[model samples]
Target: MFKRLAKCIAFANIKGGTGKTTTCINIAGYLAKSGNKVLVVDFDPQANATSGLGIDGTTIEYSMYDAFLNQCQGYDGIPITKIVLETSVENIHLVPSSLNLGVASMLLQGTRDKTGILKRIIEPVKSFYDYILIDVPSDTGLFMLNSLRAAEQIVIPLDPSIFSLEALEYLKTYCRDIEEMSDHVINQITVVLNRAIISNSTQNSSGKPSPSEEIESRLKELPDPVFVVPQSLLIYRSQQEGLPISHYATNTGKIGKAYEAIATHLSGNSNVVTIPEREAEYAS
Candidate 1:
């Protein structure tokens, strides 16, 4: 039997447009490119990660929602192996999410182990991957809790916004509370600063640090390693093509380099790039 050694990590943030799905997809792409097998679990109800990997939503016969719905309804849940699907990227697989995912949460309303349901479903597939990245939603509900309980590592992706800062503080306290409630320690935490406006020529009319700069400064105060992903048009273009920045961004650029560093660091390779204490801009 293969050993269950995959590092289950969650790319999470409590606000939309914070690059939660983007960070997760790029990280998964980079990891798979490095010969590390990866499994991306689209735990979010929106299922952006599923389609972002080029998996057609209409073709999915089984998904993470089915697994939870079956288990909650006392039916024989489908094995994760059966639900796992090949993605556009080699060495990477995905447990796609569907519209019914929100319905599955309703079924867990009164379950004995509501939050542990996802953990149970993922346990069986842990041996097949080196990294299992869960793309969770922006909330403190069952979905977020389930992923948090199941993950050994957490990556908080944030953009330049006041709401993002609030989310970060909230998550810090929320993770602590969960740790106290359950014995599961969040052994590792990484903060990824996304959508940073890194422009040297552009001048802020307000004469104050931009939101991205302010958030960067605040994150520096934390002990966790922080990575910066600059705002680029290529990110949106790549998403439109349902491909990761690493895969679509074949050119040498700031965005790709930053993500590569993150994948390397997460793989325990090196203390590579971090949020440097300097003003840099990603040319659009």
Candidate 2:
């Protein structure tokens, strides 16, 4: 099982409300469900990953922050049994985040090797999981720099909105800076367009093209995003109940199928490279 493990991946973007947390939790869960031992490191101080996976964020005594502060050398202080918490889905574990992570970020900023702190901390546990998925905060700060440094691949979740497109450009700029500043080489930073509702809303009122068509046209103008996660209310309901969409809406049809497709794509055997664009015509 350990032999099949590959590089850790971080999911990040400079924009909030992009479904970054949702995709992180779902991808980790799906990977674990597919028989890989998955570890999700929740780097967001808001603890969305922790709560999303059914772990009460406030109760976690040892978080990623503690691991960073001690340089992961004092991990022994945490009981072995308590180091990882299982999610509602089998095979998935979470390293909960604490509010103190904000302080940890401040401390990281004071260090010379700011980009490598997370990498150094995760190194000891690298061999234990088949895949490690990091859910980073929305801001492009030292925390994100550490996340990128720790990862070989990055997945950016983008909401299909004008602001999100602008944010993607900003994130790309940040990625360039990180590459210039650190020795880390994130070779696979793929983008995933999320909340892709196929609205038939277009500019021309007379037989206007669909919203999905508009989105598709936009996608055609650039290099493809890795995938487009359709907007499904199932996700919202599941999140409200602290459950992964796959687990909560397992039999709900299209949404469940979409998540399954995402899982399949992540595992490297699917034709997920081409993303279908949505038709969304925004009034400028």
Candidate 3:
């Protein structure tokens, strides 16, 4: 079981352009709006989380990179709040990422056990927030492993395309690896199909590929996803505006509605999981 944990979830996938950063922002935003104190850690070197919240990425002196190295070298634990910058929303804060983060995997390998770096660094800060959402890079590498090890669960966003199936297959293998590391009990990874057509059910109207069905069947061999994120152009535009949909009060558009629903799902009110039999097994 994960110790010192308070609902840590990572928005991750090896492939890019799958709405990883966009999903991370909205999820953290809704959680904070629900009166839950939330921290968003940008694991990617790109610093999308920082920019998404309107923080100048270049101004961040300390990033996740420092936090990991500090732990590896036996330095004093860095207070997360020191690195976190307030967003327009009161309850949500961010641990910004740096361009230097691009080389972190290489730098981390010789420094210490890279896989558990994030896990150890985050252990102390878990109690500070009701939820900690990590926005990871869109690639399977040493860096991704560290974030996965730290996560209590995983959230994957798919763009609902043909190539996405190939990516899902790879993720299934990744889940197995995480399971093997943790005594054969895989951590829950929810797959969310983003940017999907609204009317399309499990199958597309054309039957080329019903994103819901194609992904669900592939994941059936692994774990079932919680739900699909319907296509919403407003969500994309919100990110471009450097603000959360909730903050854009005037635009009570599709993206805002979808994010609210996602927040509801993440609140753990529903019995959403791969194996219901194991739900009680993993309940904290």
In model 1, pairs of residues that clash are 198-280, 198-281, 199-281
Tens digit of per-residue lDDT, candidate 2, span 1-284:
32545568888998897888999887776677678888888989898988988888767768877777765332333432356677777878888888877876555434557678778777767777888889999877788888888887888888777777788778777777888987767776677777766543364456665564455457556663456677778777878887776667657565555556666766667766464321221211
Model 1 Cα RMSD, 1 decimal: 2.4
lDDT by residue (tens digit), candidate 1, 195-244:
88753435676667777788888988888888888888987898899888
Best prediction by TM-score:
1
TM-score of 1: 0.92
Backbone atom clashes (below 3 Å) for every candidate: 3, 6, 1
**What are the lDDT figures for the candidates, one per model?**
0.84, 0.73, 0.72
lDDT of 2: 0.73
Question: Candidate 3: RMSD over Cα atoms?
Answer: 6.3
Question: Which structure is stronger by lDDT: 2 or 3?
Answer: 2
Q: Supply the TM-score for candidate 3.
A: 0.81
The TM-score between candidate 2 and the true structure equals 0.85
Error of 3 at 135 (Å): 0.5
For all predicted structures, in order, the TM-scores are 0.92, 0.85, 0.81
